[model samples]
Each structure stands twice: as structure tokens, then as C-alpha cells.
Target: MDGISDVAVGVKRGSDQLSTYKNTISGTDCMNDGASNGSDSKKLKVDAAPPSRVLHIRKVPSEVSDAELIALGLPFGKVTNILTLKGKNQAFLEMGTEEAAITMVNYYNSVPPSVRNMPIFIQYSNHKELKTDSSNQQTRAVLPAVSTVPSLSSDNQEAAGTSPVLRIVIDNLFYPVTLDVLQQIFSKFGTVMKIITFTKNNQFQALLQYSEPAHAQQAKQALDCQNIYNSCCTLHIDFSKLVNLNVKYNNDKSRDYTRPELPTGDGQHSLDSAVAAALRKDSSLLGALNPLSAAAVVAAGKVALAGQPGVLLVSNLNEEMVTPQSLFTFFGVYGDVQRVKILYNKKDSALVQMSDCNQAQLAMSHLNGQKMYGNVIRVTLSKHQTVALPRDGLDVQGLTKDYANSPLHRFKKPGSKNFQNIFPPSATLHLSNIPQNVTEDDLQLLFTNTGGTVKAFKFFQDHKMALIQMSTVEEAIQALIDLHNYSMGGNQHLRVSFSKSSI
Candidate 1:
């Protein structure tokens, strides 16, 4: 069963999900007010909005802002509306289309849940079958999920007498099995709701749930002996022992099942005094607020304190020691930062802002669990985030951009169509069968960030891929890692394997 949230974040958005969605369907500019229209008026239009594939997001980070969640959901396809229940750790997301949803479900299930520290969950949802009208609850166990689950006809919502619930015994579960990998396995047949696995005498076992009986049948038929994870050792699948073994226990939150915090996170952004003041203002930062780790305390009060809200704070830094530029220098490695500031006593910790909250979130995640310089830095979305003064200038000695614009002065055709146009001769990649969606602009963005200067970019007509030349191997490696598993408007992941050139 999927958990529902009843906590309203201020006045709840209206149920006009269709028009509200059509207005800001991309979720880019939700802050701007939009117009209203009658169903008849909308029907009068030429193209009616197409139905979107719905997604069920399980175990979303409680502190993730609605805006941040929307941005993260964009990779799946176009997001319509991201509805989160404030107190509830679950959410329901609807994607622009089913194809995009499929790609999202499969891809994100491999994301390891440790990106920025806060875990992200996405699976295909089959909410239609969560029937209500007095169905047998005993043998019929129902589940909900979003994106990339196996297909099923609407015929068997509830098997008349609630035959034995399919018992799926999963093997090869790593000592610390991850949610991402677990989702990838069970999402094959149906929505997987619960996983109960504990080691016995150095062996592991788990019970998986499927939304439909047909899904259980299909999974048994398709993956009975299939080697999961490319393992040669055959996995065991059993039928006829179909029965429900639901085990519920008190969650201790201290269990190691949670993903580890990133190595680089710390709240060194604030001064010492500010950390104390914010803790004084908000008493629960160091204490437990909701059974997760202690509320995060940021040293972000040193730069400038604005954008204050209700994120629990806990820290041990002197806010005055932090500077916006210092934190910017520390954080710029991740991506472009948009703002920074410190709050509390106006002298301690500062909240550093990034061009996107997703980047900031990613930074905060891994950084929260480590020590920096001398003190331990705790990083999480502050229930309250402060704003800092704008405008910036920084050192450029070690960066590649400074060198890209350096005085090589050997002027080639600025807009050359030469096969080796953009890159220098030495480091080149024979990217084959690249989808047409990968444009020169996208390639430039991909390569430039990795320290390569794309003097020229082109596409091949015969097989659809392009030949990219890099100035150095460092740049090429970065490009390969960052864009390795990319999807370009299709389900095909951007595969990056070594290729030997005929040259």
C-alpha cells in the first residue's frame, strides 16, 4: 500500500489539475499567476492536452522543497504537477508521457539514492487498480508505483476470490541491499511495495510484492532462471508456495539502511557565533525532530541572512569565520552558484545559493556527514535559509576556461565544418549512432564543462553519431562519465564504450 499525505502546505492547490497543469505544464514558472478557462473553452481549442503517464514517488526527502523536487523530476520528461504531502514522505508525480516515464523509472532506479544525501524515488504508478468498493482485503494485497513497471490489461484488477498472493523469493541481495537496485529487479513485473530481507547464517532472503497476479506470473515466466546482475550463478524462483508474509516492526531510523552522506559536505559557511544564535532561536537543530538524523545546523549566518523558512538547524561552527566567497570557492566545483548568505547573530553560518536548488541540494547531501578543516560541518536544507549580498569576483589561476581563452592565437576557421573542426587532433572520439536529439550546442555544453574547447561541432549523416575531439584526456574522461548514460529524446541511453579509430 502507498502512503498518502494529508498535511496541507498553506492553501492547497485546486483540483483543476488539467488546466492548472496545461498552464505551467513544464513546471518552470509556477510563481507567476495564470489564467483560467472553462472545460468547454479548452475543448474548443484545436489540440487537446494528451494524457500523461502517472508516477508514484516513494520515500521523498522530507526537507526537499516543492520547487527542488520539480526540477529533479524534469529528467523523466516534462513534469505536470508535483504534489507532495508535507508530513508524508511520499508523493504522486505525473509525467508528460509514458515513454518518458519509462526512461525515468528505469534510469533513476540505478541512481543509488546518495546523490546529494537526500534520497529520490520514482516508479511507474498504477493507481487505477487501487480499487475501493469492498474488495477482499485478506489474500489481495495491493501496491502502487510509478514508471517502467511491466504492462497489464485492465481485466484483472481483483481476482474474484483473492487467490494466494504470489510469493517472490529474491536472491543475490547484497549485504546492504539498496532501494535503487531492489526497484530495478521487482519493477520488471509490477509495483514493489515492501521488501523484507535480513541475513541468516551469512545468507540473505527477501519477499517482493507485485500489483497484479498476472505480473507475478509474467515475472516467473520471464525471469525464472535469468541471471540478474550478469551473475553466472542461477537465482532461485519458486511458485505454488504463494502466500503473504507481511512483517511490520518499529523503525529505529538509526539503521544503516540509509545511504551514506557525501564526503565533501560541511557547514563551514557560517561564523561561530551565528551557529549558536540560530540554535538558540531554534532549539531543535541538534535534537531529533522527526526520527531521522538530528536537524541540520548551518553556519550560514555570516554572509547575509534572507530567504528564511522552517528547516531545522544544528551545527558547531563559528559563523564569523565563514565568507560567501570561501563557500563559493568550495561549492563552485559542483556547478554554478546563484546566491549565498549567513544568518543568526548575523555573524556565523551562511547559506550558499546555487544557480539551481538541485545542485545546492546535491552539495548539501554529501557534505553533511564529513569534517572540514577543523570543525564538523552539518549541511541540510535549513528550515530557514538566509540571503547574501550579490555580485562576485574570484581567482582564475587553476581553471581551464582561463586557458581556453589563452593566447594560442593560431586562428582556424571560427565556424569550420572540417571533420576535426572543433577539437585538436590528438584526443578524438568516434561516437556512433548518437541520436539526432544531441545537437552541437548540447555537445559543446557537455565537452566544455569537462575542460575541452569545442572549436567546431558537427554531426555525421551516415550513422547519426559525431566525432568529438578533445584537447586533453581529462576533458574526454569527464565527458564520458557525465554524458555516458544519457538519453536523447528516446529510451536509448547514451552508451559510452571505448572505440578504436581506423586512423
Candidate 2:
């Protein structure tokens, strides 16, 4: 079929005959114009060689193991052999057939491949096949005789009645995997509807549900046995027996993205507490906390005092320019700011109440020392548990504002990417949701009106997102405060946030 031989047929070609073949096949001939050293040693590079059974990958991360390299080819077809040139950070992967290699090259060309967050380039190699000495020790370790590729395609799964839920178990748990990490990785394939994580039988396990069974099958085919980190925290995924997951809470342990109004549970502790308890119970559970969980721990502090009360005292504001609405928009980046009350008598100070204790702690930790309206503001937990509203007849001059029902809350939805993208104010701002009609000049002029010099501007390839750098961090903050959620002549509202990247 399609001139592609089956893997079983390739295996019968005899490894002994293949081993005697020289390893002089050129991997970069397509790009280098047929130049070769005529030696086995070669530096693999991106090429546009004619379709073959082998593919060349460049810029591979040094820590990448054999399994990770194999995973790069598994989703497309059977990987019969692999050769990693660790010293050169390159690898040559041999698929079972030329058609499979062509499919892999096309798919990766569109999506790209990355290991440990480092982008790698892939292309077809001139070599029709790989011939490594089967007797070599390193070859034996990295090359498998034949990989058991999953034959369950989307069509097959649909006919078999596959479930939308996937059961995940993390083996070699050297890192604390949080719900946010899982969501970020899996959501790339589809819309993750819900997730629930817990430890069972002294092993960390999770149940994740996709919006469709096809999405689950695709994710399973891609991520099963893939390492979340360098060589640890490998994911072992399978179709769950249940058709769907029933998530009850929108907390660190479990989340339901479709149900944003769900409570964070009555007495739920942060994810760190659960991980720590598991570690105490089993010494083998020792591992480092990921950035998301570490940030949560640092924000919430000790488990005994993890409940930091949902009120914050913010001071040293530019009273003339500060308003409850401004504070709501600024602090909403971390969590939902429920109510904001600018103290009438002390116009320089205000009390901001968040949706919950965890949100308050997060807002305080991230915004404590940020600049606002030309003033370095200070944010700390207030003794008051909540911000009190004005009396019925008291004329507070609109200083006291309640935003409990505001539609601009960034973290209102569970498993939001915003939760992982929180950064301190910077000179660079990320602008998204731009209308197709909005041009660069329009955005440049809009920010210039805020009295800040637009140093540089860049629109992403899609044109819907961009990065604009201001003259200073304070200017960027002021621009963000003024222009965030501003309408751009269409139903779409502009989304602005401090970016860790620069144009």
C-alpha cells in the first residue's frame, strides 16, 4: 500500500546484513550540495532531501534520553531504529517506511518538535536507512529492535467507542506535577474540560477529560509514556474506563473549566500540602516542586497559616489617579479581585478583597512591590478579613466599589493559561485579541497618547497578538492600566499584560 513496507517486513531483512553496511550515508547532502567527509562521523543538520526511511534532527537537547527521541517518531509510525550523536546534539531516526518518514516530516514541519522547551529542527535525510553496528554497547542501549507502535487511529477509536477520559500515572516522579502543568501540556491537543489529581497506592495518578473522544485518542497517542521533564515524571496514559470525569471542585486538586462559578472546596489545602504529606508518608516520593507549585507555596506560606484572609492593604498610591476600577483591573491579573475600597479619609491607602484566601495571597506576593501610576505601591495582607461596603446614606464619593460580579476577572475560569503567565510589571507589554482591521500605526498611536514613547512594536505572524515595549516599566504599567480591555471598533476587546519577553 502506498509503496510503504510494513515494519514486520523490514525486521525480516536481517540485522546481520544491515550491520555490515557502512555508516557513510550522508545526512546533510540535500542542504550541503552533496559534500561529505566519506567517514562515519557526520554532523546532522536540517535538510530537504528526497523522502527516505530516515530523518535527521538537529539542536537536540543534551539531556534528552533515547525514549524522548523515540517518542518524536512514535505518533506518526513505527520507529525501527534510532542513532543519537550526543556529542553533536543531533540524531537520525529511522522509521519503518519512507511513507512514514514523509508523514512525520510534514507533521513536524507544521507543528515543530521540542524537548525540554528547546526547539529542534527536523527534515528528511538522504540516507535510505541506518546501519549501526549491532554489537556496539551504546547502540544496544539506544536502539530497539522494533517499537510497538499503537495502531489505534482516530477512525479506529471512534468505531471502538473510545472514552473521552484518560487515566494518567506519573512514573519516576522526580518532579511535582501540578494540574496547571498537565492542563498546559494536554490542552495543546484539545480543550481539556476537567482534571482531577490524587495519590493512589503511594503513586501519583490523575484523570483528565477532553471535550471529545477524538481529542483524547490523539493526546494518548502523542503523550503516552512521554517524559514531562528531562528524564523523570514520565506520563503513562490510557483510556480511562469512565466515559467522563465528574469534577466537583475548582481547586488545585481538581478543576472544571466549563464551570467557572464552582467553589474551590470548603477546606482544601494548597497542592504543596498534599505533596508534602505524600512525601512524609513515603520517602521515595522525594522530588523538587515545579514552578507553579513552588509559587503557590511561597505565596501561601506555611500550611498552618496558609489561610491568609481574603483582604489586602495597598498603600502609597497616586491618590489623584488611583480608583477602585484601576485597582481591580491591575490586581485582577493574578486572581479575581472581588471588592476594592479606597479609604475615604486616607486617600493614599485602600483595601482590596480577593475571591478567596489563596487569591489574596497570590495577589499580594506578585503585586507587593510593583509600580503603579508613578508610585511604588506596597501590598500586604490587611487585618480586616473583608472590605466593608459604605452605609446606605454615606456619600463615599465613589471610592468604595464592589466588583464581585465584574466580567473582567482573569482567573475566573479554572485551568486558565493566565495563571501560569503571571509576571511582574515590565517595560514590554503583551497585547492580544486585536481586530483584523487594527494596524500597527493604530496601536502605536494609541500607546503614544498615554504619554509613553513606544520604543518597539512587533506583531506575531497571526496578527492577533503583538508585543509593544514602552520607554520604562512605569510607563508600560500606566499604559496597561489605561488601555487594557479597551474596545478596538469591534466586539473584541484588547487584552494587555506585562510580558517577560521583549520585542
Candidate 3:
């Protein structure tokens, strides 16, 4: 493959050169296009890209497989190769020519996107745009920090277009929707400004406000026909009907809107509780390491950043013994442990965030690879930088939101110093000695493109393991076949595999 090389060369160079290694630290390598040859191969033909062009696309789906990216991006021309970064939600679409790259960018930017559920941002990569000392200098144009939390108010800020928001009507409401449940469902839309439920005879009427009309419409679309608590508890949704609060109390629209089949405590229900049980049954589900208590893990992660508003990881604690929330108190001693993260499997391994760069440096100078919980507690900064603060910890809303708007919104440097190995494990992909030009996103995108339909993709805070999820198991096998010794971008061959996940 001409104009193509992968990570092996860079990984080897990195590990060999850096006495001070940190997966969290990003590196870059200028093109050493030594492998491009004029070959008559069709595979090479389909894969060959112009000797010198790069595509810059944003607002791509996170779940979109690397194959899909190739499919979507290749239309611009044989993408000699494409790369996306997991740290931020964006991709580096290197095309056959600057013309091709520019053509692709303008083509997409001309109209509303095909898969876009939200607004999209994209453009060409100008060399002069890059900043100094940053591994991800290519897409260095500042973007909004990753945030998916829907707005809290329902007012139509947009006097124009909007997505639909689901309309919900509750029937057998023995109790009004609690704040916990309200936050759970409404937050998914954006943010909830207000929720009100009134009851007279165990039956309740409720009004829910979502950030956008589209979100309300979507909620109505999916949940309208679905049951709420269980199969026996059917839910009714009304989209066109809203009580005219301006007029006197009205009973017609409210009652006719929907009906619920109430339960008679002793009655048998058809729904199985199996799904809930299954999720709870597996404690080692998320990744190799159990994440610390949601609250604590986020706090430690935040503090590790030294006041930068972003997500954090906690390490150096066992799920079987101590609770992640409790262990975070110890991190608080270092500073405001914004968030704490515990690995699902790497017991005692944790990640913590401080309030500012100085604090993060303090913890790093004092705590990198410190021993704790029968294992060494690794402490370092995180790469999940964001321009704006997220709505909350856990990064759930942020990750989803980043996936929606633009893939580039995914990475931010608010420039917090990234925490390296808070919990370094023996079983990990050791990528180092990278030319100070290689980036975490570059490495991740390489494997994902070659790896097939990545089901879930994550760069391990740094580069320990880029956990991949495939559309099907077969793609994983195929990726393995094609990747053995195959090289890309920086004269580097990739290390690809299917192993234990973040769990």
C-alpha cells in the first residue's frame, strides 16, 4: 500500500527512545512514504489514494465501523488511509489528493448531513492552522468540548427546524415519577427544566419538558408503544395533545389522550425481570477494571485535571473489597479529587483528577505508579480534554453528544495535563517511543479501520488497549487475517487483537 504505513514502526521507535513513558502523552510522525509503489493490484487500486491529500471530517458516529468510515470517506477517492481519534470525537481523513480532500469536505458541507441528528462542522486541514508541541495538531481548530446533555428548557430556541420529542402519558401511576427516574429519562433528551405529576386515585397525570421538540418527538416515537415498568404496565403517549393551561382546567384532552392498564398487586405480569438481573449479575462488564463509584470516580478524574472540567478515571482499588466511592476520600487528600475511577478487573487500579494543572502535576510528581491496595497505584493526567465543562460526571451524556454533533468535538486540551497510568497493568499494549508527532487518535483510528466494524472503541485513558466492539464476531477474525504485518501511516505495522475489554 503506497503512501501507507501503520503504528508498529512508531510504537517501536517510541518505546526505544522515551525513558519517560506515558501512554497518555501523544506523539506525531511526519510522513515517511517509503512503501508506495506503482502496483497494478486491484486491491491496491481500490485502496490507492493521491500521493498527498488529507480529508477533515467531523460529526461522524462513534458506533460507525471503520469499514463504514472507509465506505463513507472513500467516495472522496481512494483514501490511501483514514484515521480517527478516540480521545476526541473526530477523524483525520487522508485522501488521494488535496483536491480530493477539499472536494469531500465541501461536498459534505454543502448541505445537511445524511446521518446527522444534530448540526455538523467540517473543513479542510491547512498546515498553517496547527499549533506547536501538540500531537493532534492537524485538527487543532478549537471546537466545543464534548457534551451531549440535552438542554433543560423546552422553549423553542430555534424558531426554525427541530427534531421531535416523545410525548409521554402515564396511566397506572401509583406514585408520580420520582426525581431519580425523571433525571434518568429526561437527561437522555438533554436537560430537564421541570417535571410535574398530579394524582387523585393512584392514577397520575404528568407533564415533561425536554430540551428540544425533536427529542420529545423521538421519546414519543420509541416509548409511545412500549410499556413503562413491565409488560403488564402499558404506557400511553400523546403527541398532538397538550392541556391548554391557559384555559380553565380541561378534562377532555387529558383523559382521551391515553389509557393505562393498572395492576392489581396480586395479578401476574408477563414481563420477565431477566434483563435487569443479567446486567446486575455481571460486575466485571464495563472493562478489565471496574469503574470506581460513579460519583467518586468522576470526582477523582476531575481533580486530577487540576480544575479543568472533564471526565476522570480511578485506579488502585478492588471492587471485591473496598467501594470506589469510599476510596475517593483518600484521593481528596491530594486535592479536590474531581473524579475517581476504578478498573473493573484491575483491582486497586484507579485514576484520579485534581482541580488544575499545578495540582495534576503535584499528584503526578508524587503519585505516579505509587503502590496501593496490594498493587501499585498509578496516577497521571487524562487525555479526555474538553473546551467546556460537561453536565455531570461519568461522561455518558458527553460521549453520546460528542458522537452526535461532530466527531472532532471528541478531543479537547483545555489543555489539562493528561494523567498517565493511575493503574499500570502488566497485560497491556505498550506503545511508546513515538515521534513526538504521533497521536492517540492516530493509533486508535488505524486499528479501528483495519479492525472492521468496531462495536465499541476506547483508547485506555492513554494507549494501553484500544477496546474494540465489532458489528459481528466474524469481522474480528477477518481483521486479524488482514492486519498481520500490514503497515500504515508512519511506516508502522499495527498490533491488532481481540482480548479482554476495559473490564
The numbered model that scores best in TM-score is 2
- Tens-digit per-residue lDDT, 1-503, candidate 1: 01111111110331222222233223221111111111112211223223236665545555654434433444333444455543335455555567656656655665444213445545555441222223323212211122224444455434412422333333332111322333344444454444433322222233444544566555554445433322221234443233343323212101111122212112222112432232234211121112221211111110011222323232444454455444443444333444555454444455655544434443453344333333466665664443434334432221112112312111223422221111211245546446766677776777787656655445667647776766643344445545554666566655442222322
Span of ten consecutive residues with least summed lDDT in model 1: 1-10
* TM-score head-to-head 1 vs 3, winner: 1
Error of 1 at 131 (Å): 9.5
Ranking by lDDT: 2, 1, 3
Q: What number of backbone clashes does candidate 2 have, counting pairs of residues 3 or more apart or in separate chains?
A: 0
* Cα lDDT of model 2 by residue, 1-503, tens digit: 11111222333343333443335445353343211222234443453578888887777777665546655665444576766665556677888778768767876776667765567778777778775554643332222323432346646666336678777877644334666557655654556788887655435678788877877786777666556655455677777656666666787568876665668775353234443343344323223334342111111012113334788899999999999999998888767898999998899999999888666765765566568987888887787878888887694489888898988988778766776566656789999999999999999999999989999999999999999999998898889989999998768999999787877
- TM-score: model 3 vs. ground truth: 0.19
TM-score of each: 0.27, 0.43, 0.19
> TM-score for model 2?
0.43
Per-residue CA lDDT of model 3 for 204-321, tens digit only, reads: 3345545456556544443443333322123455432331111112121111111112222221221124422332332221111122211111111111222232334445544454
Candidate 2 weakest ten by summed lDDT: 294-303
lDDT of each candidate versus the true structure: 0.38, 0.68, 0.36
